[model samples]
Target chain A: MAVTARSRRVKPAGGFELAAWYFMRISGLFLVFLALGHLCIMHLIHNVESINYNFVSDRWTNPQTGYIWRLWDLTMVNLAILHGFNGLRQILEEWINRAKSRVVLRTGIWIFAGALLLLGNYAILMFVKDADYLKNRRDASSDAVTVRADVDRGASSRHPAAVPAFDVLK
Target chain B: MSVYRRGLVSRLVEGLRYGGGAGQWSWLLHRITGLGILLYLVVHIWDTFLVIFSPASYDAIMGFYGGKIHGVEYPLLRWAFRLGELGLFASVVFHAVNGLRVILFDLSPIRAVGAQKELFWAVVALFFFIMIPVTFIVIHALVAEPTPVAAAIVFPRNFVQAFVH
Candidate 1:
């Protein structure tokens, strides 16, 4: 590949894009095993039919587990997301030659990445919070079967995000 | 003209041979895997966000793909899913391992093709060193069961936690 004028004009030397290239490799290397393990367990061993809210819930809530799933997913989602957006940014730069178009595309990418980051974090953290709700309810309602039952019902609610919303929305 | 230094067909064959060296291979794998992950990430982001609207809505999507709604685990679909899983596994591994090598080679003083070639081989060596056992664990979990095998190996979360704290 010769340093064609078009290529030379576009190449930004030694900065964020360069750093992002480095980050993609580092993050990708980590994602290899993490993603592979996730795929094996979720897709291979159990099969898709077996995956449900309950399945996801158990991984987050089981006595055998801890905050492991929550944090692993958090790291996985964020890293995958950041790496992906950076990679796309490069493609966008190449494809969208016009400076104005590049800016618009970059802004769109940022907005998209931000929305994903927000929602992904919310879903993962909501599960974590739900786990905490179960833990506390178990600890506090040891003697109260009725209370345990109620908490269980509430925790398992269609949108247990309702503890706040159920109060406000209702 | 420079881009097609060789004819298209010859260039394709040369690419298949990895004629440029490890650097070229890294570049190739990164683009392929990056696109692969990007596609999946788009769907994932959409699905994860669906939860905000309603868990039922999220379940509706999962139900279609995985058959989690009626507990109808379709056997035939399993093979398709398995193929996808393996593809994703390969993409993630290649992209990641090659990515680390890219970072290291770029950061180092050596920008020569010779260094890039050598660094590429080193990265491949490191990738295999880690991936062989990981491959076993993945296979075992796929074949037998995952709970004991996958988590029992490196258990990366705990390992990383210990490293961090």
Candidate 2:
């Protein structure tokens, strides 16, 4: 007896699913570099203990290379967020069978992702170094001993007990 | 005709028991890690946003992440969060490597079908190769110095105070 063969015709890829599929691969390619580089810088080159308001301000507000850092961050925020939520959308599509629920959830994901994207972009674009904070640094720079004392005094006075734990750990 | 629906837990259990080879396991882990990272991404954006919203508040929150609140230290919580970051790092490394395998398979399904197992192993190898040294550095950083916390502060005692004051 001979067995019957399954259908061999290929379905042409198009529509939202196709676009989404392409988007994942492309965005993922960029993220492999963008994200891994970011992790390397944050986790490997410099540990989290070193990161603080000053570190961020210096990186984002430096006259020489601030724009490069900002653009790097902006690209990372957009690609990573979009890529992540799109993956979520795919997962939801797989699990949720109800049409109405799927619609609501999809809309909710987009709205939520959109809001985060907006906030991230705004933060990157609008960030300005605090002048008062900078002035404190500038004044303290004249003397190394005074710098440490002044910063400790200033930080504690401005924001009581808000000093980072690294001081104690040190 | 009658239709029967199975619960999510049962389906997951069944999937776990069924032998679908490395491909299936990789697919499952991809989804798991992808979801985990997505969850992190949401909070990360918000935390970074706080930098502009209030700089002092941001620093205070960062202090809390470093496991100090009101000048008090929690070593246990700090270590726990650091380990969690390690896990996050592992997940990201795995997800990224496995994602490349997926892209490879997609690029040439006919050729890749035979190499799926090899591709999976390659992904695993790459993940470890990248993670081993990085893991050492991370752990060394944690032990040698009191590394600042990069993870979330679930209880925002200082976070709230930064806003109030």
Query: In candidate 2, what are the lDDT values of residues B63-123, reduced to their tens digit?
Result: 5665656445577866776787788899899999999888887788888888878888899
TM-score to true structure, per model = 0.63, 0.80
Instruction: Give the C-alpha lDDT of model 2.
Output: 0.72
In Å, residue B105's CA in model 2 sits off its true spot by 0.2
Fnat values, candidates in order: 0.35, 0.51
TM-score for chain B of each model, two decimals? 0.68, 0.82
Task: Please tell me which predicted candidate would have the highest TM-score against the true structure.
Answer: 2
Q: What TM-score, to 2 decimals, does candidate 2 have?
A: 0.80
| Candidate 1 per-residue C-alpha lDDT over A90-142 given as tens digits, one digit per residue, 9 for 90 to 100 | 76565467889988998999998988888888877775324454465357556
Note the residue pairs that clash in candidate 1: A25-B99, A28-B96, A29-B96
TM-score of candidate 1 chain B vs. the reference: 0.68
Which ranges of candidate 2 are over 4 A from the true structure?
Answer: A1-12, A134-170, B1-5, B146-165
Candidate 1 regions off by >4 Å? A4-50, A61-68, A128-170, B1-19, B50-53, B56-69, B109-165
Top of the candidates by lDDT: 2
